[model samples]
Target: MNRPLYALLIAAAMLSGCVTINIYFPAAAAEKAADRIIDEVWQLKKEQGAKPEGNQP
Candidate 1:
């Protein structure tokens, strides 16, 4: 009803109209990342429970 209220409503409406959203889905990248993680885990397992520079078991 007031001038300030009307101006505020107009500004809000203009701002709401300027919204943009972007979504990305990278399946190939995700598969590559998973492969790298698996490789690291296997390497760690192989190095566990073994002497750093000795062959004694």
Candidate 2:
């Protein structure tokens, strides 16, 4: 019984080690997304600056 348990554990460990994870994303898409975010931030800043300030003492 002990031998079988040890064999099962070793087989599980080996199989788990064989797994591989792959992540893929397009560079052009990422660049376009970044540009859009930057443009939005810049536009917001410009709009904020353009607003007239309230009367101050």
Candidate 3:
């Protein structure tokens, strides 16, 4: 029926106004993360030739 079609059109129009999209990129945060990863890799290399601390067999 035309009544249902009109109702569907009105509902579609109402919902169309609610569309929103947002995107964000944090460069400082990404740089900090990369630095931490690099530090961990270096620490592992430094400790590779060192003995483990604490009780061990």
- Per-model TM against the reference: 0.35, 0.34, 0.35
Regions more than 4 Å wrong, model 3:
1-22, 44-57
lDDT of 1 by residue, 25-56 (tens): 56656765665587598654534443243343
User: Which stretches of model 1 miss by more than 4 angstroms?
Assistant: 1-22, 44-57
lDDT minimum window of 10 residues, candidate 2: 48-57
Residue lDDT tens for model 3, 1-57: 699999999988776654431134656567656656876987644344343334344
The number of clashing residue pairs in each candidate reads 0, 0, 0
Best by lDDT: 2
**Which lDDT value does model 2 have at 40?**
91
* The 10-residue segment with the lowest total lDDT in model 3: 46-55
Name the candidate, 2 or 3, with the larger lDDT value: 2
Check candidate 2 and list the clashing pairs.
Answer: none
lDDT of 1 at 20: 30
